[model samples]
Target: MRVLITAATFRSHLYPLVPLAWALRAAGHDVRIAVQPSLVGDVTAAGLPAVEVGRGPDFMSELKKSIDSDGGTPPGTAPSIDKIVVPHIRIAEAVVADLVPFAKNWKPDLVVADPAAFAAPAIAKAAGVPLVLHTWGPMPDQLWADLTSERTARENWPKDLVAFLDTWNVELGPDYADLVVDPCPEELLAIRMAKRQEARYVPYNGAGVTPDWLDEPKRRPRVCITWGTTSEFMGPEVLRPPLLAIEALAGLDVEIVAALGKAGRELLGDAGEQVRVVDWMPLSMLMPTCDALISQGGPGTVLAALVNGVPQLVVPQISAQPLGAELLTNSGAGLTLRPDELTAESVVATVTELLDGDSVRPAARELAERNAARPDPTQLVATLADLAAGR
Candidate 1:
């Protein structure tokens, strides 16, 4: 079988689909990732073949420019749902034009796409293939509704596009996929929007060498602090100023691993020995050794921590982070602090609570058990094959 996996031009969006892509390839199916030219390297780095389908203005830069002109909030602050979906719709429109021709030529049997890849439905329809909507986290039906309504009016799309648009109109449903592959735990998910296939959230934070220190037994309770890779785009200011969390945790008994990018590391000046700052390390490799995690609530990071059974203190910076944080808090697996609420004192208190408290870890363990119980990508290959064959 031939499969085409599509994603928007972001590492976060692309990474979620990696496990399944690898699974299909391992099962002897031909697979290729269709993405913007900028994301080709990311796809290739994951050891997958990539097809660069579109060319145009850079989406993230345009989004940053729009955010700056609006002056409503800082760069990393979460945008309104309108802001989130419009740019994606614009990118999808450009990509789909290129994708349709490629889909016709390549003739994939199945199309697995990121939730935000608005072009998937149209491409799948044109190619007469089954579409699977794979999510990094919980489905945001409201955001999809807003996006579809705006696109339907603005694009005045053709009849083939209507099926995708109609998906947004339906209540409590997935947006035009034959099957939905969700990685989030059932308890943490906000809604079940489709006939679903549950997959465990396997962390793939790019291919990297595991550090020697990661294998050594820890002398003290370890806490990982990461703002994720988006911090490279948003700049260091996206995190709390003056490195409040690191400063506050200075005197604590715990060892702090600050897995910051170059920009984020530069923002921290002369931190104490207790804080070990490195530009990049795989969280999947690092989290299992840690007692707790302090993160900006990226779905990958949050789920990685959950899978590792580490309690978390989430300081959401933008986008779906806040909602993810809330769900984690509700599940008793973690606690959340809004951007405004983030301070050195707050960080210290939260981390202390997470470290000392027994309830959170037990809850985290429960969530982990639930997540581990879900089928791995390798197990789901036969089901996807059947769907691709129109079974």
Candidate 2:
């Protein structure tokens, strides 16, 4: 069987699918990823075949432009409709058009998609294949509906704007997908996505092949700071404060490992000792040894920390981050701070508390065990293969 996966261009979005894609191939299925051309290298790096879809500035570049024009830092909220949803909708349409010609030729048996790329389901519908929606975070269906209703209800929108906004809600009706895979956990999505018969709560997909470094010794209590793939679009103004806050913990006995994406490196160059910036590191390898994580509240990062039994301090980038952060806080594994209210003093204070407190660690360990106990995705893929074959 051949499977086609349509995902956003971001590494965070595409990376989670890599393990499962490999699992499918190992089980004798041909797997191909349809993503932005810019992400081709990453797809190939994970040893998956690449299917290029769409033409536009890379997703993050367009996002930066959106911020630059919108004035200063984005307000804290669920990803702004303009920032994430609209661009993705455009990218989805472009990706669908890009994939249609190939779909006609390749004739894949199944279409797996990241929900943001609405066109994947559309393409699957056109090709008449089983559509599987893959997610790293809780899929916010109600929030999506609210956003759609708000846009359509806007009397201020120009006629053309109203039509474009209506396009945002196109995926809401039937003909969406056959199944939705919430790869995080059922507990995480219980409040947000609820109990939908179509939804399956699988474990995290990209758990990563453990690296040899896990056996080595290190002196500094390693601290990981990351914002994940879309960090480039999320300006440093929102992220830097947290780092400065960490730096305020100057005398704390920890080595701060800031795994910055490209944008973070550019913004906080040579912050001197007590801070180290790497372009990227495989968190699966690094998180296990880390003492604590200070992050911008991306779900992927939050889960990585929790699954590794590492506590976290989240200064959420937006509402989704806060939502994930809130889950962590509720689960007793982490803490959250507002970016606007975050100061170096607050960061130091929070980090000190998390590191000094015993409860967070036990909570983190409990969460880790819970995550580890979820179904292995390789087995799930085997089952999915059977379903796709109508077994």
lDDT of 2: 0.68
Once fitted onto the true fold, the runs of candidate 2 whose alpha carbons sit more than 4 angstroms away are: 60-79, 141-175, 190-215, 229-231, 262-273
Best by lDDT: 1
TM-scores for all candidates: the values are: 0.89, 0.83
Which residue pairs of candidate 1 clash?
none
What are the per-residue Cα lDDT tens digits for candidate 1 across 40-102? Answer: 998999999999986895787666665666675555556665555556766777887799899
Q: What is the C-alpha lDDT profile of model 2 across 1-391, one tens digit per residue?
A: 8899878777667766776787788888888898888888788777778887897746665555555566735443234555555456667667767787888789989988776666776677667777777776655443333333343335432333335434534333333456666666555563323222322222243335554545678677777788765444444555565457656767688878777767777877886777777777777777878999988777667767777889898876665666667777887888888777787777777888788887888888887887777665677776677658977
Candidate 2 — worst ten consecutive residues by lDDT sum? 194-203
- Output the worst ten-in-a-row residue range by lDDT, candidate 1: 166-175
**How many backbone clashes can be found in candidate 1?**
0
Rate residue 238 of model 2 by lDDT: 58
Superposed by TM-score, candidate 1 places the C-alpha of residue 346 at a distance from the truth, in angstroms, of 3.1
Off by over 4 Å in 1: 68-76, 145-175
